[model samples]
Target: MDSVYTDVGQARKAVEQHLARACAWVDMGGVLLVVSELVTNAQRHARGQWQLRVQAERHRVRVEVSDSVPLPPRWRPGKLDGSGGWGLRIAEQCADTLEVLTSARGKTMRAQWLHPGRTGVAVA
Candidate 1:
């Protein structure tokens, strides 16, 4: 599923709906966390339209968030006062593999979670 959203809440809702139809293979909570973090980052930093693409299979689900900012996301030390800077770390921990691709126009943050027994293997 692919969707474009200018609002963070809308992006979260769209991802929730897409995951509802996927098979019970991947960890939904982890995926949702990753999606939320990525989308929230785009909204807070990119400050414009963003696109979300979700691909689910029997053993894995890949979530990609594309925004109009060419700058890649950075990790800053977490603060005790919750003054920001933890989303990337949380997303990385929740996903099996997290990658960032940058272009002149924008960047895409891709997070994928593999089923417990299917790590590093392709699903047939």
Candidate 2:
């Protein structure tokens, strides 16, 4: 599934719908949290629209969030007062693998999670 959203709330809702229909066996909370962080970062840092693509298979799910900014997100230490700086860390912990690809026009954050007992290798 592919969608573009200018609003954070809408992006979140789209993820929820995709999860329900395509990835019911995956961890809902983890996917939601990762989506929220990436989408929120796109809005807050890129200050423009963002696109979300979700690919669900029998043994894995991949989420990609693209934005107009070429810079990748930074990882900062968590704050005690909850002022800021924990999104990337949390997302990394939840996803099996996370990658960032950047170009002159934009960047894409790709996160993937494998179903339990599924190894991180292609079966072809």
Candidate 3:
């Protein structure tokens, strides 16, 4: 699924729905959270409307968030230990593979999570 939304809140809801239908509801929430952070970062830093794409492969669930800014994302210290603000770090922990690519049009952040059956077994 691919979508472009100017509103971050709407984009978040759309991502949640897409993931929920693609996977388990609870698992979707986690994916949605990561998607939300990516989208939020794009909106806050990028100059134009962001784009999102999600794909379900046999081996993994993939998400890509693209923004107009070419600069890469950075990890910064969070305000409080449990008070959020660590989106990139959290995404790195949740996603099996995460990448940031640069292009003339914009930058894209890609993240993927391995499917349990295809990956042999889920890590504890």
For model 3, the superposed segments whose C-alpha errors exceed 4 Å read: 1-6, 81-85, 120-124
Considering only N, C-alpha and C atoms within 3 Å, which residue pairs clash in candidate 3?
Answer: none
lDDT of 2 at 12: 70
- Worst lDDT run of 10 residues, candidate 3, spans 1-10
- How would you encode candidate 2's per-residue C-alpha lDDT over 1-124 as one tens digit per residue? 2334246677677778877898788988898899988887776778757888888888989989988889888777889997778888888999988899999999999999888878756732
The residue-by-residue lDDT of candidate 3 on 12-120, one tens digit each, is 6776776666765235766777788887777676754688887765567888998777878776877775655688887887787789999887899998888766667
Q: How accurate locally, in lDDT, is each candidate?
A: 0.81, 0.82, 0.74
In candidate 1, which residue ranges exceed 4 Å CA deviation? 1-6, 122-124
TM-score of candidate 1 to 2 decimals: 0.86
TM-score of every candidate = 0.86, 0.85, 0.77
Q: Local error of candidate 2 at 101, Å?
A: 0.9
User: How are the candidates ranked when ordered by lDDT, highest leading?
Assistant: 2, 1, 3
